[model samples]
Target: GPAATWDAVDAYFGPLVGEDDVLAAATTRARAAGLPEIQVSPAQGRLLQLLALTAGARRVLEVGTLGGYSTIWLARALPSDGALVTCEIDAAHAAVARESLAQAGLAGVVDIVLGPAADTLRRLVDEGVEPFDLVFVDADKPSNPVYLDLAVRLSRPGTLIVVDNTVRGGAVADAASTDPNVLGVREMVDRVVADPRLDATAVQTVGSKGYDGFVLARVR
Candidate 1:
């Protein structure tokens, strides 16, 4: 019931913002290719684009690439020469995202790496790539804490980091919950508050996507 209302609100306000034909096509293609329909909502995607623009980001690191939906949104915020590196563990999902990104004309701007996210992030760190201006972590929930740690390593001072799906429909507040996802998010929250290298906060959100939230942190 509430989700329907949220969807209605999104539909009403979505037109106030611009809609991209390419984005719609990307979703359609992803569905046809049997990809999970778990990408961020349109409003969230716009928020990401705005955050990237606000940060004046030239380099963006994304820990997940699901059909490249969010990847497209983030890449659009970058300058022509800007680059985005996204990690995807599933080869099938990576192929779908690769095709979608190419259709979105962002194939050249975004690199889709197919492998375990943690290993990929570690490799990036070992390669000594330039620090990212903004980092988005949206992969496996059980690895959120690890992802946050790695994301920080890939970031420079003043870098912005966004970790999605932290709320998990409010289950994250259950200290005794046995869900690996919830426990992982709680651990991530604990780490964020304890680490002096980060200044962070979280915001709960309700929309077509439900009652999940995201953590926003800035490197100190």
Candidate 2:
């Protein structure tokens, strides 16, 4: 019942916040391409765009690109010369993303890097790519610790890193949970708190996406 209410509220407010036809078309394409419908909600995408705009993010890094729905939102926040790089492991998913981004007119500004994200991230580090103003990590939950560490390495003094799906339906609070994703979230929390280079906090969210949250950390 509550979840339905959340969805209704999201629908009610979506148009007030600019959830338009282009975003809906992206979802349609993703579904037609047989991609998982696990992308963030329209409200969430708008929130991301607002964050990037507020940060004046000229360069954004996204660890997941599921049909590029979120990537479209992030890329729209960038200036003409700005760039957003997103990582995807599946060729089919990347293909769908390419089409969606092309329709969104973000193909030129967004680069979809296909392959294992860990290797790609390491290459970017080795090549000393310019620091990202914002980094969004939403890939495999089990590798969150690794992603967190790498995201920090790619950051400058004021970079903001957002880790999605950290709460895992509130399972992260259970010390005895055996789920790998839960354990990964716990380990990520432990790692963040102990790292002197990071100042972090997590926010529990409930919406059409259900009970989950995200970790928001800033480089110190």
lDDT (CA) for every model shown? Answer: 0.93, 0.91
User: Residue 2: error of model 1 in Å?
Assistant: 1.8
Q: What is the lDDT of residue 88 in candidate 1?
A: 96
Write the residue-wise lDDT of candidate 2 on 70-134 in tens digits: 89988999999999999999999999999989999898999999998888899999999999999
Q: Write the per-residue lDDT of candidate 1 for residues 1-220, one digit (tens) a residue.
A: 9999988888897976555999888889999999999999888998999999999999999998989899999999999989999999999999999998999889999999999999999999999999999999999899999999999999999999999999999899998899998988999999999999999989999888999999999999
Give per-residue lDDT, candidate 1, residue 131: 96
Off by over 4 Å in 1: none
Off by over 4 Å in 2: none
Question: How do the predictions measure up, each by TM-score?
Answer: 0.98, 0.98
Residue 134 displacement (Å), model 1: 0.6
Clashing pairs in 2: none
Q: What does the lDDT read for residue 72 in candidate 2?
A: 90
Q: What RMSD does each model have against the real structure? A: 0.8, 0.8
